[model samples]
Target chain A: MRVTYHAVYLFLAAMLSTTLFTALKLFGVSPNLFIIYIVFAGFYVSKTEAIWLGLVFGFVYDIIVGANVGLNGVLYMFACFLVVVSCENVIRRNNAVVTFIFTAVWTAVLEGINAIFGPVSGVWPAIRIIIVEIFYNGALAVILYLALKRIFERLYDNEKR
Target chain B: MRKLFGNRIFVLLLTITISVSVVLGVINATKTKSTFMGNVAMVVITPLSDACTWVGRKVSGFFGYFGDIDELREENEKLKSEKKELEAKIRKSEGTDRENKDLRALLELSEAYPSLELVSAEVISRSASNWYESFIIDKGTADGLKIGQGVISGENVLLGRISDLGSTWARVTVLTDSGHSVSAKVIRSGDLGIVEGDLSLSKDGQCRLSFISKNSDIVVGDYLETSGLGGVYPKGIEIGKVIEIKPEVQGISQYAIVETSAEIETISKVMIITNNPAESTAVGEE
Candidate 1:
């Protein structure tokens, strides 16, 4: 992807994640648009490019949110790293099933990390959050994947032309 | 090992991962929101964040105005049920001067407390993290705001406090946010416990009232209010309702979960109790 495209893409993702995503929460859990975007973009891009984009945007997300500074960046960067790594080594293609599973695993890992460091009352409750969020994020990820695929496909075509 | 280190992406990932982890450790250890990088970024990011929040809220509100048929149907059913209950209660109380008594009581309450300085503000943005609950409101030190002031939805409902502030903006960490604690009591039984926000129950719009004794008379459906023990949150503000209770091995409560009365998401405007009457009294005494 062009640098400008990446810039615009992440910018839109951050705006949505912070505002629209937070506002339109379903069952009080909004989709983590940053995570969704990074994961989606990571699939189509080179490993180095994906990691850099993730690192930059992850830092931005962490700074803006500030629950734990650098924590969001760490998790998101790793999530992108692992997803791209998985694509090369594990998954054959970025199909719906693969994307769903990747999103689910990525969400679980991030939630686990968040829970470990986050405030908690019990294990079961933390697990409940992880489960609920994974499903919410996973479902959203599939839809986002298809939409992004269409958009990126067009962008690639434009670049080729 | 040489070849692994030779690869640039791996090196970058490893370096960033360690750097960010170390940074997280440092930030967590010392102070909140004091990082140099963060402070510098705020110069540019703050306005963009504020605008995004503003536009987001407006757009969402615009859409929310269009009623969803299914939600409306459910609301209609709920309202119809509530109407029946209200009618029954109204008929039962037809002979009494209850309305007059209630008004007189309200009048007495209004007279008892000293006049509070309230600053009206608009909610501009929500916290970027779901794990934590807070939002930015468009009022700050410029408007006589300070740290630890109480925020409310309207009259009696507790919202949160001004955790951090800019010159003209402040972040109100909602009562539902984890790491937030409110000293509150069960109004019915006078059972006292600290209502604290827990991340686990946050998604369900609930908080936890901890430190209730083993044999406290607290029960389900008991109303909770700010106990005024802490002197931060004003006394007698309705916080939430007890939804569920968790018990320890010895039958003592772990905590009682409370569903907050304020829907922090949909609220566009809030009232800040800029100067608590109790705090003012303390100031006067000294």
Candidate 2:
């Protein structure tokens, strides 16, 4: 994918994450679009490019959403690193189930890190948050991943491996 | 594997980024004031979020109007009766006000406390993070909104205070945030206690008033107001009403759960008190 397409997706994800997702909270939880974006980037981009994308998106999300700076960045960067590294060794299966599972795993890992280091109310709330995000973000990841895959395939069929 | 580690510059950049991020996270988490980068980020991001919030509210409001017609009619009838009663009281109040003006002048009570200086601001967005109970307002340093200025409902109910700001935006940490604490008193009993946010209660738009002496005659439905012990907030602002009371686990004291008159979750606009009367009193004492 081109850098311009990456930038547009990142901006849209950041905007929706901070605004619409906030108002649409269910049981005090919202779908994390950034995690979905990170998952998308990991599969489509090189390791270095994915890492940079995650780092920038995380920092931007933190600044927009959190009083505590850099926490999201670290979580996102680590998530991207893991996702990219896994992709290198793991089979590149372009399917909804695979995308959902990948997103669910990363969502749990990232939220777990956030719960430990972030100001979570208690163990129960943290557990609830992780479970909700895993399902919500995993479901979103499947739909978004499929849509983006179709769009990218149509735009640059030869470029897609 | 050797090639991955061989890129010294990439490794160095990664290390530096992580180190800086950790330092910044620690600093921002610990500090009360806004950091430079935070302000910069707010400047860039607030406009986008604010615009999105505006659109979201408009769209929601349009849809909500159709759904709310029945509720609005019921409320309108209730208000019609209340207005008639209020009009009758106003006539009686005008005569009492004339008599009290003379007594007020003699006591010089007005000199003891000044009226609040407030600025109206619309809430642009709420905190995206679940951990923090806060919201962004469109007014900021440009509008003379200082950190710690109290944000309140139109009826003067205490909501929160400005925790941080950019030139065009400010973040108000609500009373339900775990980090927020204030000294408040029961209006009915004059019993003083500390009002603070608990993570458990906050989700339900409730806070707790702790350290109430076990002997005090506090009850559910009692009103609570700021005691003005803390200089950060002005005195006499209504915090909330006590909905429940419970003895402390240790049996030494008790606490009361407070529910604000206006629901914190649905608040869309608020007034920011630019001046702290308590601070002015301290300055006068000094």
The C-alpha interface RMSD of every prediction is 2.4, 3.1
The per-model lDDT (C-alpha) reads 0.73, 0.75
lDDT of 1: 0.73
Best by DockQ: 1
lDDT (Cα, 0-100) at B209 in candidate 1? 89
Which segments of model 1 are wrong by more than 4 Å?
A: A88-92, A153-161, B1-12, B15-19, B34-75, B78-115, B252-254, B276-278, B281-286
Chain B of candidate 1 vs. true chain B, TM: 0.75
lDDT of 1 by residue, A28-146 (tens): 66667677777776676667677677778788877666556777676677678767676666664677777788778887887787777666667887787678778888889888777
DockQ class, candidate 1: medium
What C-alpha lDDT, on a 0 to 100 scale, does residue A94 get in candidate 1?
A: 70
Per-residue error for A146 in candidate 1, Å, reads 3.9
Q: Which stretch of 10 consecutive residues in model 2 chain B shows the poorest summed lDDT?
A: B105-114
DockQ of each: 0.50, 0.36
Candidate 2 global CA lDDT score:
0.75
